[model samples]
Target: MPLHPFHGRALARAIACAIASASLGAHAEDDPQRATTLREVRVSAASHDTSVDPDLPSVVETVSAARLDRLNVVNVEDALKYLPSFGIRKRFIGDENATFSVRGTSNQQSARGLVYLDGLLLSNLLGNNWANPPRWSMAFPENLARVDVIYGAYSALYPGNAIGATVLMTTRMPDRLEVTGEVQAFTQHVHDYGVDRDYGGSRQSATIGDRSGRFAFLIGVSHLRSNGQPLVYATQALSSATGGPRPVTGAIADTGANGLPRQVVGINAEGQEATDQDEAHARLTYDITPDVTAGLTVGYWSQDMSHRTETFLRDANGQPVYAGPVTIDGRRYTLPANYFAPSTRQSRNYLYGASLGTHRDTGWNVEGNVSYFDMDRNRDRVASSVSYNGAGLLTAGDGSRWRTLDLRASHTPDSIAPDTHTVSFGYHYDGYRLANASYNLDAWRRGGAGMLTAANGGSTQTQALYLQDAWQLVDGWRLTVGARYEQWRAFDGSRATATAGVRYAERKETHTSPKASLAWTVSDTVLLRLSAARAYRFPTVNELFQGSFNGIALVNNDPRLKPENDLSRELSAEWYRPNGVARFTVYRSDTRDTLFSQTDTTVFPNVTNVQNVGLVRTRGAEASYDARDVIWPGFDLTANAAYTQATTVRNRRNPASEGKQFYRIPRWRANLVATWRATGRMALTLAGRYSGRQYNTLDHSDIHPDTFGGASDFLTFDARVTWKASDHVDLGAGVDNLTDRRYYVYYPYPSRTYLVEAKFHL
Candidate 1:
């Protein structure tokens, strides 16, 4: 199927319409309090320390704690929901598997980005897909001071994962005694696929902090409880079965994403889940000197989850049908017995971290950090039969853990001269061990480990050394150059079943990456920058050694797989004015040996798993406008539009993917947010998000998206209102997905949702 012509240029049309409105709606000269810094950013809105100017030539986005309070702050990820060209897989309030996506990447690619909290790595590098998302529940929204995002892999200080993006979250240290508390509640009504109901949740958080002389301590806790909407529906392709069918009603005749006929019977698999999550964290910091500080942080998170399934099909006598043959449109169909079975999971995670760093304007400075993350206890109970308390399986990950270490030093000259420069050097080490084992159980909910059923486990390690230098070439020109050398190894790869177990030999590889950035200040109000880099991303543990099995026979395991090589480049032009700033950017990326999961349609029976593709090319452009007091004294606006096109150039094993659009990446994305302050303490906001055409299959076979199992265009609007009751209290209300548009991204997204919140401070 061919794309609709007008929809292909969605970014262009959206930008044009927005510009037309802004020209007539804004008065740039109205605001007197808005500040702008062009050549050098010496003044900021926040009081936090963020002098990491290493990502000079790339586009960076920053938001302060004050700005976050105006939006719905139920979850920390909500702070980034309005950013441009960003995709987050936060299905519900307490979803534990939320992943991050940016630019040309998909939300399922969890290992292609970096997330840090107070210099501690939060990204789980054990795997490369949905199962390996960042550990974000440990950071409560009320405890953050600021958040910064750096685009592209243009800095030598970070690993190859920086090619997607780098996020830095800074926690606050109080100057005096402070206590804060917040409570929030939300609800959403979903009506889709013969299922209609209301799902809702609630959250509560509190933080206490104080500073006494050279010592400071902070403690925070938060909890969430939610009932999510149905995420899966049972369906079977229209087939010719040679058997008499039982008459059943409520079976929906539908077409699949690929235009194949199917019957939608009921919700199955990961149906509706009731989630309860709790997290606690504490931080202690001491100032050895006025410019030197040491800190220790401990965080713990836990989740107890269970599920409930519902059926729509019924027999002739009005009895609900759980399984067996049924007739839909005179065609015989059989619903699997285990289709509506539910599973339960319990998870306990802990993170301990320490950091020692110096804060100085010039001369030598040193910093050291180390963190350890462990899955203290984990169990996933899966049922094989729908019968009550029947036999099942238990998967345990009790010994899975990861460790990280970083040591860095930097020197800055006192003055800007021909020989003056800022030099930074660092050494980094990271290790991850995955230990997962499954055993047969006598009962689903109340059962112990019985016989060995299946197992998959592996270990990965990376060590790197890097150096970078930034210097002023002339009056208005600055240049930066750097390189990183890394050695990656994978070992202790093993898989097992009831029969036997097997281990893979150790594998090791070394690679060097180069990076550069150049910036030229054309004038006080304009600047131009160019950045280029080459990154090598090593395969993760699951991608290297993990495989599926069919009755003890090995399948889908690849021992010989190469790393991914990516060459990325970007150029940007920035304009500054009294009210705000505007920027235009273009970027391109060429990659080889790309690690991804795709189904080979050329084969007789489709096989879906992780594989390496030969070549992929992606290019895009973005335009952004951010200004405060655009029309009135307290009016602020921020908007951005982007266009991206990613295509597969070559693939030897999966030829059907060549010359087709890459999976899950939309061709266009746009966002808009505006705020109006009615009084000194009252504010109202309106926000919009858009995503254009996307495909679920690499061959572009999933046409007519908007059905289940397809990646479709997404567009939604959000609004929020906040009022300061007093100097120590605040209240807020908001709505998301105002139109309740029906859409899909392989799963039905949230429908019309309502929110209410209250906060107190002393």
Candidate 2:
């Protein structure tokens, strides 16, 4: 559907009028002497790390605790599902590989976005894949006060990672004694090819905090466990003649869009992944003076997972030949019953941070923060493909570590001139270290020892300086201008292959980014904004140094990969009333040297590596409407829709890929939520989410339906009800994907799921 230029204005006026009329008529006759206020003003100071004011031209959205609790989400990522132009690729309830996408960006491009907790970076930034996602498990949901999502990288304090969007989570420090606990249980009914069963999960969390004099402390803990469905399916190529040693049970022929016939040999190759997670966090703060505060925080997280698969292809005596030669169509074929590869993984992480800051009523304020994250342990053991019942291979993992330091100061001069300025300057330093190794095990299923096969390690450091000024040119006009200079270096980078000894290299580069935004308060109830920026994202160590060997044929990585540079622009309009807000924004971005994992298929066996894709472009528009009380009391609604066209503008390396849509990004997305408070203690909410068609491959050839790697358009409905039984107790029940819509992100997504929860507050 095409958007009319006047739709924004019409929708805004309709919402404002409805809210004003409802508020005035709600028991207003009883108080005729009281005056009505249709508009409310909200003022907030600029955030030091983001360097953005609430009233700035940039687009920013905040989700409050009340709204978050009503959603009854399982994690921080789940809470953001309903936001405009935002999507989370959560395959299952407790999927650690879950990632997010914003606007034109895909989940695989993790470096395009940024995630932060308490002004500290949480995005892994180690590699752009599912295994390397933001450390969202670090913060317990009970400890979060609010979450802020800033659109675009139109801020000097942030790096190019913010080119997509920036998510900032703020934790709360109770001013008084407080205690909270919650327990939740959920189950999903799944139905798919060779997979039809029920998966269950549960979570438990608790938090306690207290404040006395100038000292405050808070602590929280959470545990989660879940059984996920199959991760992959087993299949075999179809043959013209049927002579395959008597077909096995449950073997069915299928044809895909590519006009090829295949037989499904069995159910899920890696079946039912069971995972357990435990996490804890603590925060301590002390007031050194009336306006100065010092704080420290520590966080720990760990997970253990194991899974096994079953093969339906049996042999002559009812014995399963995990791997052997089979006669198919009179042609001898080496079929592997061990195609179902099972594995186990164990991981642990720790985080520590300290901050000192002083907030003043006027003049200048300064804040400094230092933090570190340690990937203490990460190991994976896989069953050998050659022999499933025999020994396996162990990838003894050596993980990564990162540290950051930020020092910033902001000043608001005590001037009475017609114009006012809020100046901000900051210095940032970030360091990352990564180590990975692979080993060969004698027996993985039985916990056998292993010998090292290949190992490599690397480190990166970045230093940056930025300055920004938010100038209020007049009563209703403002302009924000900023610039940032960053120096990035990769040192001690090396790769060790089984055949080759080792290769090491070091690289360095510098870039400068500039941003500018203008805002105009068109009227008491309407506003307009325009913003633009130029940003660059440096290549990651894995993208530059990691290489894979296919049967001793080395597929080399590009150490001289150029940084991704983006030029972005946005125009937005907003209308606000006391009870509602409506907004519309149109944005465009052109990026060069986009990093992509591609295959140079010209060789006998395809070689894969991260390379620079020439140029890409995206254009999109977003419209949103939110209201607390539209036409009736105790009722609220939120609705949003987004349309995006992200495509490759130029690709010299592969001419066929040009003009194709980006992978895994939908052309249209929308969400709707309606909540009704039946009484003072009871409330119900109904919501629906819709994602349009998208491709899983760069050439847009994934047209198969209900098949893995062929993602199709999907829509789902959800409903929740909450009952406040008492002042300190609450009970809730909800259903997600109520219609049981089957979907896939390469891996089949969850089906109709039900959840029940109970919480207590003191």
Candidate 3:
């Protein structure tokens, strides 16, 4: 193997760092910019023009931990709320089911995007829905160094899931002994139909780490407790007769068209649920040689939550109504106060992984990482009926695991070709398995073997090979091209019940994804890039085998769902200066066989299942401006705007949805933030975000904006201030949704929330 011109320089730098750290009784760490700087020099050496690769053909953005701290983020989702064309449906603080959306990707399609923590996959690919969102809680904000958001599937290094977006989070590795602790308290004031009160929460965390010689170790733990507002609303049809056997709850004037008595604006029967969560994580790293490193990591998370509700309706005797009807002035009414069922849920999750990697400036560099996640415990119990009868357990036992292997080789020719070139080739393998089961129960108070309601699972495996090359064709032009071939298979697909058993046949698919880009240096301060790509995303285990159960074969597990394919193109331009940068991108995507879950109530009987649409198209543009020390020595500002129009073009299976906008995707959004360093020990920041109205159904039939059922436009404000109280102590306070903007994304979002936090470090 031959070596590049900068190979010797990179080696000398690495050796120098190693020797310096060894003599100081420490472990060597890679320089943050070493890789980028070296790659730039090598690319320009052939053209005899030395210029940095400041702007790649692809659109990528990075958010550093320092910026997160300045914003006083509350969680991993909060830290990413300001990214361009990106959003997360976070109903409340400590929400377990937070789902993210980027560009044209909707939140309901959880599998369209990918997330990684230090090269370990955190995305839950077993299913594609709100419940199967990435394990964001497993990634602690305090442990993160930075997060990179890759906008498109323009690289062979990632799978087709990157067609929507790829989020990579890198954690901090301690160079020396360190200890940190934090305490936080928060509260929100809610004012909906029946809910007019304050709910609160608290969190505490600690971390410790050290690096000595050739080994390093770190451990972190966190605990949180919260009382959240109701997630479900009670409703009744306006067309229903007033007289009924069931009791009635106090009614409120209807807001939608078919006006009828809906449940009064108040907490639902389940009321507020109190939640308790705990997380623990540890990692150990060792240097096997001067150029090789090995590491192991383990993480565990658990939750205990329970809640009970009280009805507002009462009988003649003033007792809270539980059942039966009542008459007033010869008028009869049906009340459902008796059907309020409270519930409790307990679950525990675990994650473990191991990795080995090598680094070298010249020749080949390779890395391998494998991870497994298990659902240790999952059980939910609910009241059998509205009479406060015995409780019944809903046996939902499910688990999934993914194993990934990657190997790569890259080298830059010592003797330059016609143009400077760096070539890379890699092989990848990933296997995923899901086991799901559910059971019916007779008595809620006691646990016993009940009839099996559902039992099904499936597995998906993929093997892929890819080759990529980057060439600087001339002094001011560069091109990158890559292609990947993947073979995918779904096996062990089955569905069964205690009385009847149904099985599905195995499925297979194959695709070739190609990517290309051309970048031109327009001038010393401007750069322009145009790119295009073709990608495919396969169905998950749940999408292929998880079926709804009824008396008949409605929504039978169809084993022949086709993979989704997308053709995308983008044009981007960036202007750079000493103090700030501005960037704009316009992109479009045309997708075929798009997978989505649909409600088919008119199919003789109601049935909900996942289906594929013929074609869908999306066009969008994003612009952002970032500056530091804008008007003062310590002032920073960032502003961004996004517009996207995602619509179904053709769908033979559901023609009514054609020409309608995609669900839960706002067409317009804007975000702005400003930060000021008031003093050496103090900082203050303020932010604002706005989102336009969006649809909740494929046909866009939901026109009314009710607090509980429809998506509504909203704008919110946030502010935070932090002060260094001492050398080892810090204090901070912040307010989210400062304007108390009332909005809904099918569920009421939090309003006017405040938090206070304190931190100690050594």
Decide which is better by lDDT, 1 or 3. Answer: 1
Least accurate 10 contiguous residues by lDDT in model 1: 39-48
Which pairs, if any, clash in model 2?
322-337
The 10 consecutive residues of candidate 2 with the worst lDDT sum are: 32-41
Which scores higher on lDDT, 2 or 3? 2
- Pitting candidate 1 against candidate 3, the one with the higher TM-score is 1
Question: All candidates' lDDT scores?
Answer: 0.82, 0.77, 0.73
lDDT of 3 by residue, 378-442 (tens): 66767655534464547565565677776666665554344977777788888888877766667
> What lDDT, from 0 to 1, does candidate 2 have?
0.77
- Top-scoring candidate (lDDT): 1
Q: Report the Cα lDDT for residue 713, model 3.
A: 72
lDDT of 3 at 728: 97
Give the 10-residue window scoring lowest on summed lDDT in candidate 3: 42-51
For each candidate in turn, the TM-score is: 0.96, 0.91, 0.89
Cand. 3 Cα-lDDT: 0.73
Q: Identify the runs in model 3 with alpha carbons over 4 angstroms from their true place.
A: 1-57, 243-249, 256-261, 265-271, 307-310, 322-338, 361-363, 387-391, 412-418, 442-449, 552-556, 600-607
Candidate 2 lDDT over 155-222, as tens digits, reads 88788988888888878788899999999999987766756688889999999999999999999999
